[model samples]
Target: MGKKRLKHRSLFLLGGQPGSGKTSLRSAIAEETQGNVIVIDNDTFKQQHPNFDELVKLYEKDVVKHITPYSNRMTEALINRLSDQGYNLVIEGTGRTTDVPIQTATMLQSKGYETKMYVMAVPKIESYLGTIERYETMYADDPMTARATSKQAHDIVVKNLPTNLETLHKTGLFSDIRLYDRKGTKLYSSIETPAISPKPTLERELNRKVLGKEIQPTLQRIEGKMVQNQHQGTPEFQAIHQKLESLQLPPPPSSNTPKIPGL
Candidate 1:
């Protein structure tokens, strides 16, 4: 039998925080481009370990730290092997740091692959809630196999996201950079290649200043729900409430404030 050949080799990186639906979006991209695109997620490898459930049960919040090294090695090996074979690939990451994606994109680009990036521009508060909701739902379905995202991990990603976005943009590695909300709505995109004649290049400044206002409505709604459910009193819920409150926009600078003069 002969090795299968891909018509066009491409690398798609779908990135977001821990619970921002990267898995679903990655699956959709694979399904849409059925033949050659292969998914290389560390979580998939991590979950497949025979002792994974046991480790999760034992370590709880610390499980990811214990097992991620093994998963990362496997994921990296797989990425290298698949790339060498001329396969189209889709990988998911937290986008917490630029090192992995930037390195991967650089390697694949050198291998005659077109690299593109999709960012899930979910609100920090929504993603924080998402992690809790996902864990509870999964735990209800099957306690042994359930996974919980740690608050520290989620918060670290959220805190570094603005810098990560700017770095990725400045690198100019990806031909297509897209931002989508939790509901999969297209919030922004920078497509630079085979340009469209009519549409001018649309670039959205995706930083804390912009996202702070964007996340306001969702934050308010979630806080209201927490109160209505009487969950605001619980330790976990209270912690979440405090986090959301901290994300609230700051007061505008007063007009009466004196401005510095160049003279």
Candidate 2:
């Protein structure tokens, strides 16, 4: 008898801003797959370091620059090894740039693997707050093991996310692409009727969240409440709160936003 092919040899690409809950969603997907998937999260590699705690304390945000290259090489090697064996794979990233992801997707597609992408559609204000809260919880539980997201890096990813998402979709390398929220709720799915495209839907939702008249007032209220809270009394959070208060989110691209070529 001839060897049978496995349809489950799939690759899932998970990308979002740093605090957009990619890790949580990855965990959920892994659980649903019952550990049948190989996860390639760069942060997972960073956290695996023996001196991760000490490094975070010593270098703070610069910790990533010092150690990420080694872990990144390891991740690349794993992708190569696992894809050869036809294992279902899940890769997580901030989608800060379109190059690596597009390249990875193209590589996997050439291997006769079905590639799928899931992007988190989270508001920047909410995601920025999420980063602070995540650090606070992790640092409180175990200072040595806690890893903090760089504010500068987080902001960069936040700024570039829309463009990155659009670029990936336009590439047409993945068979499917989905947009999800922090709570694991599916906000938009590309496989739905093609009449409803991802770009316009993503643009509208993101704009509605931050470009409205209520945004500034809402931010002020959050900042005032944060000031009253004991945990949020720290100077770091105060600076972030102020930044969010003054943040000027871009409006929907309207005429400038490109349509998804064939969509």
- Candidate 2: where is the Cα deviation over 4 Å? 1-8, 27-35, 50-61, 142-145, 210-233, 236-263
Which digits, one per residue and each the tens of the lDDT, describe model 1 over residues 1-263?
13354757888998778877776676446555664477787887877666887888898766767788889899999989988888888888878889988999999988888898877776555566677667656655555556778778887886676567667877889877777766666666666333331012111222223344455565456556556545455555555454455566454544333321100
Off by over 4 Å in 1: 1-4, 27-35, 50-61, 142-145, 192-234, 237-263
Q: By how many angstroms RMSD does model 1 differ from the true structure?
A: 8.5
What are the C-alpha RMSDs, in order, of all predicted structures?
Answer: 8.5, 9.2
Candidate 2 Cα deviation (angstroms), residue 195: 5.5
- Give me the displacement of residue 114 in model 1, in angstroms: 0.7
Clashes of each: 0, 1
Estimate every model's Cα lDDT from 0 to 1: 0.67, 0.69
lDDT of 2 by residue, 143-259 (tens): 555567766878788677777777777777777778877677878776774434566655555444555343445445545544544446565545545445336554334432322
Worst 10 residues of 1 by lDDT: 197-206
Screening candidate 1 with a backbone cut-off below 3 angstroms (N, C-alpha, C), the clashing residue pairs are none
